[model samples]
Target: MSHAIGAPLIWWVSDYTLANESALIVGDDFGSIAKVKLESETGLKDIEIIQQNNQQLSVRLPATISYHSHALRLYQPDLKTFERVWLNAPKIDWLQGDMGVKTSTGQGWLQLSGKNVDTLNLQDAFLINKTGKSYSLSLKESDPWHAVFNLPKQIPVGSYQLKFGQKVTQPTIPPLEVFIVNQPTDFQQRVLNIKDFHQSEDSIDHTIAFKTALADLATHGGGTLYLPAGHYRLSNSLFIPKNTQILGDGNLATHLIWSKIDKQESIALINLEDNTRLQGFSMYHDDAAFGINSPSDRVINNVHIEDIVIRMSAYRGHPTSEMLTKIYDQILKRFSNKLDTIRLQANNITLKNNDIYGTGRSFAFIDSHGINIQNNKFYNGRRGWYSFSGCSEIIFRNNTITGADLMASGGGINTLGNKVSSRNLYFANNTLGMFNGWDREAFTSDGGGASYFGHVQSHKENQLLLATNLRSKGLRLTPYEGAVLFVVDGKGVGQYAKVISMSENLVHLDRKLDVALDNSSKIIICPLQENYIIVNNTISDAAIGIQLYGTGLNHVVYGNTSIRTGGINLLGLWYGGYQSAWYTLVAHNALYGSANTRKFNPTRTDLHTSNITVEARPRSTDELNLVYGIVIRNNQLYQNNGVSIIGSQNARKNMDAIFVDPLDN
Candidate 1:
C-alpha cells in the first residue's frame, strides 16, 4: 500500500469521552483493535488498545493527557490499515486584550499565550462582527509567536471578534473595536489651549504665541496644540514636531491665514515631521500656500491629515481676466501651473476627508510607500495627485476631482518614473473631470519603463537595423544588452530576437528572424514589472481616460466607464531597459468616442469595431511583436472597425476569447 504524505488522519472524540479519558472516538469502521502507539522523544511507545467498537475504542495511557502535545498511531491487523494523527491540546492563558483603536488600514498587535501556539496558521483567521459580517485578516508581518494584522480599509466601523482556526466551533479570542476618529483616546490630556497664550482672532502676529506653544509642547514630549475658532494670522511657517497633532474647532470655525508682510517667493504654511496629525482646520494662502512640507530624509510615518480645508491663491484677491483666460485655457486645453498644495516625501501616510481648492498641484508624493489618499475632494487644482521617484503600494481611491486647469501638463493622477520604478500602484473608483492641454490624459505615465521600435531598416548577420521612432534622444542603451525584442506586426510577427547593442536609431540583434519584415512591422522591448490593478473608475470630459507608456507586467484594467474621452491608450514600451507591457487584461470598459474629434483625441477607439489598433510600421526582415499574453475580451465597444488584433490572432466579431501561454492552456 502506498503511504500518503501530509494527509490529516481524522479522530473525533466526544466531550464525555474527552472528560472521562477512557474511550476515544476514531470515526472509523474497523471491527477489531490491533495496535496503538504514541510518538515519544526517543521513539514510538506501544500503548494497549482495549475494548473496541465501530466508533469508539479505549486506549491505556501512562497518565492523563492533560494539555500536552501528542502524536498517536493506529493499526488494524485484520485489514492491514495504518494511520497517524497529530493532536494539540490548546490552553489560553488570557482571553482578552486591548487591540487599540482600529482605523481604516491601521495596524495593531495582540499577544496571546497558549500551548502549541506555533502551529497556528494565521492565514485562515478572520474577524467576525456582531452583525455576522466577517473580514479576512492579512498578516502584515510576524514573528514565530506574535503577528500583526492589518484592518481592512472597507470594513465597517464597529466592534468585532478576532477568531482563529478553521473549525466552526472555534471560539473568538478577544473583542476588537474600531473607531472613526483619527486621534488617540488620550489626546485631550495633552492639548495646549491657545486661549491661555492670549492669542485672539484680531491679532495680526500670532507667530510668537504659536511658536512658544509648539516649543512648550515639544519640550515635554509632543502633544496636541488646540486652536480655537478664530482667524489667526501667521507671518512665518509653523513647524510641527514629531508625535504631535494640531487640532482646531472645525474647518469652518478655525482659520489660519498667511499674512506675511514681506513678499516671499514660496512659503510652506505648515511643516510636519514623523507621526504628526493635522485636523479640523482651514488654511488660506495668498499667492501659493504650501500646506504640509516634509523632507525626504525624515523617517516620517503615520502622518494623518484629515477633515481640513486648504485654499491657495487666497492672497491673489480676485481672479483677473488673464488668470481666468489661463484657467479657461487649462480647462479646455490641459495646461497646468505646477504648484503643489502639499509636498511630501514620507511613508505610511494617510490624507482623508479633506477639501482643497485653488492649487496648481493638490498632493505630491515622492519616493514614498504605504500612502492612502481617499475620500477627498479637490476643486480648481491643476493636478490631483502626482507620484514619482519610485513610489510603490500607493492607492488613490474614491476621490472627487474637478476644475483642474493644468494647462498642458499633469492630470487627475500622474505617475512618472523619473529616477526609479513605481510598482504595485492601484487606482480604484475615482471620479475625474476635465484637464488642460490637447495631449493631457486623465491618468498618464511618461518614461514608465518600455520603449517602442520605429521601423526595421535592414536585417543582416543576425542583426536587425531599425529606425528610432519614439526612442529617447539621450537614452543610454547599454543596460539592455540581454533584453528581448519581439516583432509586433507584419510577417513573422510573433518572432523575437535578443538585443545586442542599440545606438541612436539603430538596433543590433543577436538572432536572425524566421521571416522577413515589411513596412508594417513594429517591435517592442520586453522587461515586465508586476501588480498594477486599475478597476471600476469613471472618467468624463477628458482627452484620454488612461494612458500607459513603457513596460508594465501583470496589470489589469477592468470595469471602467469613459464618457466623451479616449477610453484607454497603450502607447510604446521603450526606455532602453528592454521592458514590455506583458501579461495584461483590458476588459469590460464602456468607452464612448466622438466621431468629430480626432481619432487619437483622448476619445474612445471603438473597440467594438476596431478593437485594439496596432500601428506597427516595420520595414526589413525583422518582425514586430510588441505585446504578449494580453487578453482583450467582453468589451462592449460602440463602434467595431474590424481591423484590430488580440494577441497574435485577429479578433473575431464579438467573441469571448483567452490569450495566454499556449502550452499552459
Candidate 2:
C-alpha cells in the first residue's frame, strides 16, 4: 500500500522466532532495516540490527525480555518509511480490575503482569472504547513483573480494549465494569430540608435559622442540605462544614439573595470547607461580598462547586434603563469595592457548569493546585479569571466568557503578583467574546520583578568568563548549572548554550562558541518547567487574543481561531530575579486582526505597533530580559494591518524567531 509523505506504513508480524535469547522477525517487504527500535511497556530502547533483508530482520532481544508483549519498529535510512511489528503477543498476560464505581473525580487502575513487564513502553499504550474513542493510559506504578495503568479522565465508563502496539486485550471472565457517578454517593441520601427550620423570605435576620440548621447537620455526620424553591434572604455569611452538600431545587427556582447593606467589610456568602459540594442555586449580592470562598487552610480541601449561578446585583426585579444606569454608576464604577464572585484558595477543587454575571472579578485562585474550572459561563464581569502567587496543574476549559466591562481593569484571564509562578496551567477549548475593558488584552501573565543577567567578559574553549558583578545580580552557582543561557546583543546574538558547570567567575557550556564574545555581550538564563497545552480555542472581538508575560515553559498554543482581535502577544519579563517564558510553540492558529479603529487601538505604542508582538527587553533601562526556543509556524493571519511579525527594540537580538506564512494582508 502506498503511504502519504512522512506517514508510517503498518507492517504486521507474520512470524516470530524466539529461542536461546536470540530474536528473529518476519514482516512484509521492509526493503532493509536501516535502524531498529525495541519498545517495551516501561520504555523504548534502540536495538542493534545484526542482520537484515528485504523481508526478514534479526537481532538479539534484551536479556530481560520474557513472556511479555513487545514491539519492533523498523526504519529506513531516510527516516521517513517505517513499520511497527508486535512481538511475543500470545504469551502476554493481562489482569483486569473488578467492577468499580467512580465519582467524576475518581480514578481507575488496571494491571498487567508478565515476564519483563518493566521493559514495556507505557507511553505508547492506550485504551480504546467500544465507540473507537481512544484514551492514553499512564504508568501508575510498576515492578519488574507487573505494571499498573491509570485510566485517563477523558475515558467514559464503558467496556474498552487494552491495547499496546498491535496486541489488544478484550475484557475477561467477569467483564470489567466501570460506572462514573456525577455526585457524591453520600449526597444521594440523608437530606435536611431548609424549610424545616424557621427561615422565611420576609425575615430580615434569616442568618439565625439558617445557622441553626447548618449546626444541626454538623452535630451529626454531614449530608445533603436541600433548599426548596423560594427566595431566601441572607443577612450574613453561611459557613459550610466538611462532608456537607448544599443542593437547591434549581438555579432559577431557588434564590439566595444577599440583603446586607454593610459595604465596609468583605465576606463570602458561602465559605466552603473540605469535601463540600454546593450546587443548583442562584446567589445574588448587593454589597461587596463574595459569592463563594474556598480558603487554603489545611481544613479545607477537595471542594466541588457546580450547577450554580452568581449575580452581583441585588435587585431581583425587572431591569429598567434607569436601574441599569444606577447600577453602572453606583455599583460597578471604579470606586465600588465589589469582591470577586469566587475566591479559590484550596486544592483539588472543581468548579463546573456554573454561571457568573456582572461581578467585579469572576474567579481568583491564590497559591492553589489541581483546579479544574470547565463548562462554565461568565458575562458582564470585570475580569474572567485571575491566578495570584503560585499555582500548578490548573485547567480552564470549555468556558464561554463575554461582555466584560472596563470599569475595573477588564480582561478575559490573567495571572500576576509577587513571586507568582504557574506551571502546567492549561486554557483549552474556550470561547471569549467582545471584551470591552480598561485592559483590552484578553489574556496576560505578569511575573513582576527584575530580570537576571550576567556579562560575558570573554569566551575560550566552551567556557565563558562571567564578570565579577554577576553574583550581585542574583546569580548563584548551583542553579546556573544545567540552565539554558542565551547570548543577547553583540556578535553572539541569536546563539544559545546550555550551562554545563559554573565556577567562581566562569561558566562552562555544553559546546564551544562559534563566535568570540567581548565584554559588551550579555547572557540570560531561564529554568525548565514542563507540560502546558492550549489547544482548540476560539477568541474574538478583543484587543489581544492571548498574552504570556514572563512565565511559561514547555508550553504549546495550537489549533485556535482568533477573530477580529490582535494576535498572540508574548512579553518575557523578569520575575523574582529570573527570566521565564521559554520553550513555547505557537502554531496552527487562524488569527484575524481587527481593522476597526476603535477596537484595535494600540495599548503600548512604545513597542512595535503590530497585530502580533513579541518583546524581550529590559524591564527598565538597566535590566536585561530574554525569550528562548519560541517557534511560531503554520499560522494564518488575515487583515492584520500589514504587520504580522513585529519584535520590540532588543527583543529580536537574543533568539531567532521563526514565522512561517505570518501575514496575508
By TM-score, who's the top model here? 2
Go through the candidates in order and give each one's C-alpha lDDT. 0.56, 0.59
Q: Give the TM-score of candidate 2.
A: 0.62
- Candidate closest to the true structure, highest lDDT: 2
Distance (Å) between predicted and true CA of 96, model 2? 22
The reply for model 1, stretches above 4 Å from the true place, is: 1-189, 200-202, 261-266, 296-299, 318-337, 380-385, 406-417, 448-529, 575-579, 593-624, 639-665
Q: How does each model score on TM-score?
A: 0.58, 0.62
Q: Candidate 2's residue-wise lDDT over 118-168, tens digit each?
A: 445555677666787777778877643346677676566555656664324
**For model 1, what is the alpha-carbon lDDT of residue 367?**
60
Q: Tens-digit lDDT track for model 1 on 479-502?
A: 556445766555444455666766
| Regions of model 2 farther than 4 Å from truth | 1-185, 188-190, 199-205, 261-266, 296-299, 314-338, 380-389, 406-415, 455-530, 573-580, 593-610, 619-625, 640-644, 647-652, 657-665
Report how far residue 135 has shifted in candidate 1, in Å: 13
Residue 270 local lDDT, model 2:
83
